[model samples]
Target: MPTSSRPAAFATAALTAGLALWTSGAPSVVYPVYGREWSLPPALTTVVFGTYPVTLLVVLGLFGGISDRIGRRAAIVLGLALMAVGTLAFALAPSIGVLLVGRALTGAGVGFALSPATAALAEYARPGRGHLAGAVATASTAAGLTVALLLGGLFLDLLPDPLHLSYWPLLGAVLVVLVLALRLPSGARSSGSAVRLLRVDPSMRGVVAQGALGVAAAYGTGGVVLALGADVAVGLLGTDSPIVIGLVLALSAVTIGVTALLARRVRAGAAAPAGALVMVAGLAALVTASAAGSLPVFLVSIVLTGVGYSLLFSAGVGIAAELAPAQHRASTVSAVYFAGYAVQAVAAIGLGQLATAHGLLPAIVAGAVVLSVLALVAGAAPFVRARRAVRTATGGNPA
Candidate 1:
């Protein structure tokens, strides 16, 4: 690729990857409205919410390495086209069934674009700036998510068709990305069966395990907060404004973007484990604040959670990118996200059901407790591995 084209290619790929989250995040702002308009339960709202991740996981598992075979730009363009269709589906949704299908299509678009776009960015980056590419990809995801929440909420508050009106801008943006995708340099092609490529390398199993756990903890907690956090926020803030809920939910994405940019230099090993621990602390605080209905503390907790999410996800992506062979980079990254999104899919519906059956407080607290514990366990794994390495280096001696 020419030097001049590199920047444009990277930006397009990054934004393409971002639409994955943008499509998902936009619906979150309208979940409450869906509940009222349809007279549906929390679990139904969650089902619509959960469908996206499930579709993402399916696409990633089956076609994760398709870009490695055909071309990165092709895969991304295809994904963007699918997302545009999904946006249209959401805009025209006449029933809950249609909304669920729209969410699934959106997830499929994300799954198609996410890993390949990230790999494309890494490949197109200037030498020695690979890490920066990874950070930008992560940050782009956060940016898309933040924009979706803010705009969705704003349109919902100000527009007539709260649900359909919010998706118009998203549809236009996806079309723009499609045009940009055509201009992006086609990544080098290689011969390989996507099935074989989709298989995770045994040597990378340990780190992949740790990354999976960390990502699961981070994304699972995020699913709960974004899907149900609006209800919790209303209780704490004593307001039903979608903008307030969106802003509150947006703290997570904003922090993720800012923190990813700032922490680009940090090593993945240090960042991942430490981030997991901090996430645990943040989740604990969130549970407490939600239970007590304290707005200030809730804000503080979300900030912490946001920061922690940024660190964990960025580090996790960095670790996967570092470990995977260049040939399998897209597949490895897809696998990592497959694990993460699968967890989110399960957590969203499970927590939503809990909220509907018990109440938001108990459900939120339970989710926090589970995520905190998962993070703690994930955080301990790196130390344990380091200790075992030390013993081997010292020939069975503790020192």
Candidate 2:
């Protein structure tokens, strides 16, 4: 009803947007929805899941910072429309072609909304509580991923009308969010110098390095495992149940979801190193899983890596926000995201290709190696910066 309540509204919008995008994959929990009903192939399933990131990366890259120039409201409203269209299309799909189209549309919608939604959170932030925006971004994203899979599975197993139940309810919820979206003040207005957005000025090589190393570590480990683990789980381990899918692929991020709950307690510098360590541990577990082809070890690794990915993702947002100038905060975030997605894209393609050749486990080892290097860099960056700062402050060198 009031402008001051916009942040609360945006938080809801972001959460909804996330939920919508995740359904594109979460319905895999209801593999019956597509697998048997449409006779969808395994390759097609990979396409369905992989297509979201492709469209998402492209849309976010081009339009990611449009809100910074055009205003957050328009970007968000457009994104919501896209998300609604895409989700509904998939829900009502008469064929796999339409399903793919729907998935593409979902990606486009979430991509449009993704950046704008974050920007909206910025505008809607509560007084004297700016970090609320970051928390909203991180938590909503994690919420979307977790809730989408869990609820989608529940509806699939328990409801007679799984498709309608899984999607229509979400569509209705987004309708409520659309109504809520109307209340947000246009982000184009000048908020004045008193409240400035501290942005990560990425022209600085240091900021780019910070973003690249930090995000690569998290995404390389978590994104890779999440994206590819399913094939390994199903193709190699020979499983068809939703519960198994959730445990292997989705549950990996569940640990990250748990870590997100601990965001407030973690220190500024600690998240990166901690994330690095946990991810490394996760990758190591993955190594065992890869060698032994043990689903149990693989499942445990997913949980551990997820915790680290969540922490690093959220922490990266904060750090990226800090490195920027006031005018470019959103773009700084965009840059960080671009790099993150870029890393994921490369890792996916490279590993996917390798998986195509050497087999899933070897491909997984490649991803682990990439992330392990990234983790090393992440563990190194803070110390380098700290030492440099100390050297400058001391007017020479360290003892």
Candidate 3:
């Protein structure tokens, strides 16, 4: 690869990473429309939402390290092709069955592309700014979500075919990216079993665990928001206008990009704990906003959630990139993503079902509680270990 092309490659890789989330979130604003048109329950709507991560989990487990063996460009191009197909399926879908299939395909595409794209960022990053890859990655994904919400809302409100029109643009974007990805220089390739490549070394297991937990918290928050944020907004605002709801929900995505940029210089170790605390506050505010039907509070919560998500996700990615062996970087990042998507899958379906059975408020509270605990544990793990090391060094004396 020529040094001159690295910047282009880096930009393309970022777009590829962004497109993965864009594909995943493309259907979010339209979920309510689908439910009304199809007479679907909240549980089934969430099933549609959760389907993506479930399929993504399977693909990641199976071939998360495929890029390491093949090449980043090849894997990304392949993923984009699948995503285009998936988008087409959504554009033409007549029934929920086809939609589910499309969602699965999109999930598989993201699973294939996202980790490789993240890894590519680190590789293509400028010499001194390599650590910024994680922040950039977080911002890219947030930008994707922001675009999906804003455009989906706009199309739904103004376009003739609300359900189908939005996806066509997405499909076109995927195709364009696919072509650009093809021109990306093929990086080094190595031979290894996908399973073996994904395996974390014993020495790095603790780091991987902490990184995974932080990512889980960030992604789980996003899952809950994407799954239920629209309905929550409807409850708070007492309106069903798609455009308004989209704007409200998009606050989180917008804040994510801002926070990532502002916090890019923050160290991962400090960012993790700060993010956890801020996330806990956001979750509390969310529950309060829902309970009181306070739109202002809801807006505050959304901003806080986005900021927290940016911090935690960037920190997690930074930790993984800093510690991962060069040969297995993609696989290591995939492992972190694998954990995040797992929690995201569980949160989406579980909370959706909870909302259907009890109410949205209870579901929100439950999710908030669980995610807050996890965030705290992830944030505190490094400190706990350091304290234990100090104790051992001092013959079991308290630090």
- Over the stretch 1-399, how does candidate 1's per-residue lDDT look in tens digits? 333288888788888878878887888778778999989996688678778777888889889878877788878888888899989999999999989888888888888888888887777778877766557777999999999989987898899888788899999999988887888777778987654435677766766677777777778878877767777788878888878888888888898899889988886777777788779778888888887878888887888888788778877776776656677777777877888888887787788778878988889888988888877766776677678778978998985
Candidate 2's residue-wise lDDT over 1-399, tens digit each?
Answer: 665265466565566546644644555566456776667776777787678778877776666666666566666677777777877886687777887797788788776666566555555556544444445566667666766666766677678877556778767656667666666666663333322232444364565466557776776765677567767677646865655566456576566666766674464367778778888888889878878878788777878888778767666665655545445556666666767777876887678778888887788887888788788787677667678779978886677
Model 3 Cα lDDT, one tens digit per residue, 262-333:
999887888889999999999999899989989898888898888889989998887787667667777788
Clashes of 1: 0
List candidate 3 stretches off by more than 4 Å: 1-4, 38-47, 194-197, 385-399
Model 2, poorest ten-residue lDDT window? 189-198
* Superposed Cα deviation of residue 292, candidate 2 (Å): 2.8
Descending-lDDT candidate ranking: 3, 1, 2
Clashes of 3: 0
Show the lowest summed lDDT stretch of 10 residues, model 1: 192-201
Candidate 3 global TM-score: 0.93
* Most TM-score-accurate candidate: 3
Worst window of 10 by summed lDDT in candidate 3: 194-203
- TM-scores for every predicted model: 0.91, 0.83, 0.93
Error of 1 at 269 (Å): 1.2
